[model samples]
Target: MPETNLPASKTSFVKGFDKWNIAVASGFYNQKIDYMIEEKKQELDEKNRKYIYKMLTFSLLIAFILFAISLYVSTYLEKYFLKYRKKIYKEVEKNKKKDILLAHQSKMVAMGEMMENIAHQWRQPLSIITTCASGMQLNKQLGLLT
Candidate 1:
């Protein structure tokens, strides 16, 4: 099975996280590892308890600050999006206008070709009409064009 990046909330983690510790909400994500180390230290004899506890506390504090900084960054990005959203929208419109102009140029070229073909088709008939008119005028001058 593929390893999914599901949140620690879904998958099992250390006892601290399983108990819904504040560290998880603070978003350090590494605090889970700290808690795991604490759990392993639980099996140790005596000297490790205070040290592990201090480590967990330090990890929690760092995680909280990291989460706060992350929140600030995300909020900054959101504000930037709000500020520049209209400019991005205008760029999209400009690109669309350019596409439409290109399409129009292509259509005009096709239309010019179609018109040229029509002129060519009509050229022979027009010439025939002029010739017949000239012949009739000559006949009339000879008294037969009426």
Candidate 2:
């Protein structure tokens, strides 16, 4: 074997040192990549949280607005219903008075009709009585009866 300027053991140590340096650099690079990935994930989580918060706030605001509108509409409708009910009550009272008047008028008409019928029924009996009295007086004058 020919002898080189560098010893064989020293050359082997140099080669092994180079390999260890490469492995350390690779490990550092891998750690940096993992840190970057973790930072990106945190940023995404923060953005999602902000989006969810905005959505929840908007939903609550819309719900409050709808509730206020419904309350106003319901109050307005309730007042309108009360006014209408009062008007209906007045109309019902007027109808009741009219019904009573109509009933009184019906009774008056029925009484008038009954009085007329009674007068008609008595007229024939009164005429027969008058005729019988006159006949008795004439028989007495002619001595046909004691």
Candidate 3:
């Protein structure tokens, strides 16, 4: 056996140390990436919730406004209808009064015509009776009524 002197090298140990350091850095990077992803998810969820709330509020406001408009319109129409009905009642009453007046005037005209006819029928008989009474009186005075 020949004895030869050689320098001690730490290449293997240095290589193993480098490998360990690389593994640790990789693990830290993976952890940081996971944390950033979780933050982004939470932010997206908050934005979605705000948008839904705003939409709901807007929809409710529109519905309330429509209901108020309908109520006002219905009340206005009812008031107008009542006024028209009152006017119609007044007109009907006026017509009825006019009809009664016309009936009374017609009855008066008919009565006047009937009275004139009765007077015309009695005139001739009354004149005949008067002539007979005067003749009798004259004969009695001359003594020829025996």
Candidate 4:
């Protein structure tokens, strides 16, 4: 067998690296992976959008059902218990008024009693003072004061 020699290609670092088929293949594979990842991301975004819309729709439906039920209950209450509720309120009001009237009457009676007591007290003291003054004047006129 005859010996054969091949010359090595001498190039700069940047050019040599770029010119290799491995680099080209790596770039192509990297680009393919990026594209695939972007496709999956788009699909996930679409799924998320659908899920959000469905959830929103479900929530709105539940809200509507609750509102309708509340309205129905309100009607039923108004139809059934309206008269009783008003009757209870009127009874309470009547009792309250009666209590107020009784309190007022009691206060007036107490005031009258207090006024009578005050008049009686003042009259007794005034009478005693007048009697003492008259006795003093009589003694003075009779020369008993000296």
**Model 3, 59: alpha-carbon shift in Å?**
2.9
Residue pair clashes in candidate 4: none
Off by over 4 Å in 4: 1-28, 86-146
lDDT of 3 by residue, 1-146 (tens): 11234333221222235655542222224444566999999999899899899899999999999999999999999999999999999999999999999899889888888888777778677777877888888888988899
- Candidate 1 has its poorest 10 consecutive residues by lDDT at 20-29
The C-alpha lDDT values of all candidates are: 0.80, 0.82, 0.76, 0.82
Error of 4 at 61 (Å): 0.5
TM-score of 4: 0.41
User: 1-146 in candidate 1: lDDT tens per residue?
Assistant: 12446544333343345465444323334556677888877767355777788899999999999999999999999999987997899999999999999999999999999999999889989999999999988998999754
Model 4 C-alpha lDDT per residue in residues 18-54, reported as the tens digit of each score: 4554432212244445769999999999999999999
Residue pairs in candidate 3 whose N, alpha carbon or C atoms collide under 3 angstroms: none
TM-score of candidate 2 on Cα atoms, chains taken together: 0.67
Question: How would you order the candidates by TM-score, starting with the best?
Answer: 2, 3, 1, 4
Off by over 4 Å in 2: 1-28, 130-146
Compute the lDDT for candidate 2: 0.82
**Against the true structure, what is each candidate's TM-score?**
0.46, 0.67, 0.49, 0.41
Number of clashes in model 4? 0
lDDT of 4 at 52: 100
Name every residue pair that clashes in candidate 2: none
